[model samples]
Target: MRRFSRFVCIDWSGAVGEHPPGLALAMIGQAGAPELIAPKKRWSRQAVLEWLHGLADAREDILVGLDLSLGFPFIDRGSFFPQWDGSPDSARSLWECIDRLCADDPHLAATSFLRHPEARRHFRHAKGDTGDLFEGSIGRLREVERHQRVSKQANSWSCFNLVGAGQVGKSSLTGMRMMHRLEKRIPVWPFDPIPDSGPVIIEIYTSMAARAAGLPANTSKIRDLATLERALCVFEADTPAQLDRVDDHATDALLTVAWMRQASTVPALWTPQLLTPEIAQTEGWTFGVL
Candidate 1:
């Protein structure tokens, strides 16, 4: 298998509108600093999905990472949500369920599914709005997530967690919808076999990449070029010029893409020892977790 020639990191958003919060993208090649890919208008979850399709259309041999949970906790509980018959058996089925339920949702938002009377029961929602079956944020981690914590690499929140600033429920749900649509077009790592020579997408947690760049867990965000350049240096990447607008979203995408370029060289990430075929089909592994 040949190494990827290009890399891209997307700071995804699950916000419910045409314009979403914290959505950004950065890309890089074999050598050089990452560059942000932005549209004239603010980014929407839909636009980002479209951009990925564009990459596939161009036949780009790239490794792409999206900052979101690709699959929920399944192996730990025998199903995505224990005791729930509707709970999907595989990651692809889960994506289909979310997409079908949220098909009418605007901006690819998972609003309808999030509000589903039965479906909402698995999530920890807003203040005083936790579901009946909902466990706390730290309770329902996937197998790889548990290993990630054990390795002391990064702390992970359940995809069912929907409250507070760290909540990734919205992003994960909406992203699943995108993944459902992306289906046979682009191969998502683990769930689909990597194509002999094309782009492959994987789940990524930017915090892990930041830690690889020598940043602390609680203070991993880089909101300026100076800090971003320093982080890039950890990967021995070229430093980009200062940009007019700089935020953690832009910085996360920039730094993580560089990190992916460096991290892909490791032999273990592609075949994590703990990642069995069943787990990959159920709860996909994060690229940098190993």
Candidate 2:
């Protein structure tokens, strides 16, 4: 396993707006002090991609964890878009498909896929609406999501459900757009082969990181400085004094990076028995979920 020099966690947003409050990023290096990146700035998905590409170009040995699903539930059907004849067979291919379909969308937004007739049928985009698309699906949980639930007891929402605050479908689709671009410059964990050097991105769940920091499962967000500091301290990370004023997004980013820093030291995190070639190519695993 490679030792990463820097750890980054992005609290990504899937809102349709140009600048969503949910978009936030934080980073922590070997020094263990977390710092908020792009503070007070409303970021577009395009800008984030450019920044990540720059990091990869620099050959930075970093482990980047983005809070989004890398791929949808594919194991049961052997494909993400099973009904569609043009459905991609692998996760990377799916990202490429989303990118190609949403090529006209600005800021790497996934509006094209969301608005796609056949594709949109598989997702629930609004609250109070039932996701009838997945009613007859063979499995709702991706292999990794099932592992996360059984092992970690984390309630991971289906990537097909785009409604509600707990829903990650929108963010994940938008994130797939970003991943499609980033794959050209960086290696995405499980989906792509990890290079010997340079930046590598992985899927992350902030709640899992919070759990590793001893936070309760019900703690959806952390706004209190004391609680945030305690979470950072769990990994012996330095708590930023500015943490007191930040909102939940910033705090989540901070805690996630701290958790990533500590998680990098665990051998099992890099190589898990569940990470078979099939799972890697189909349903990507969440980093540190083991």
lDDT of 1: 0.86
- Candidate 1 lDDT trough over 10 residues, lowest sum: 238-247
- Residues 115-209 of candidate 1: C-alpha lDDT, one tens digit per residue: 88888888888888888888764558888888888889888878888887888888999899998887668888888887889898989999998
Positional deviation of residue 113's Cα in model 2 after best superposition, in angstroms: 1.0
* Whole-model lDDT per candidate: 0.86, 0.83
- Residue 101 lDDT in model 1? 89
Reference-based TM-score of each model: 0.97, 0.93
Off by over 4 Å in 2: 127-132, 136-139, 243-245
Residue-level lDDT for 119 in candidate 1 = 81
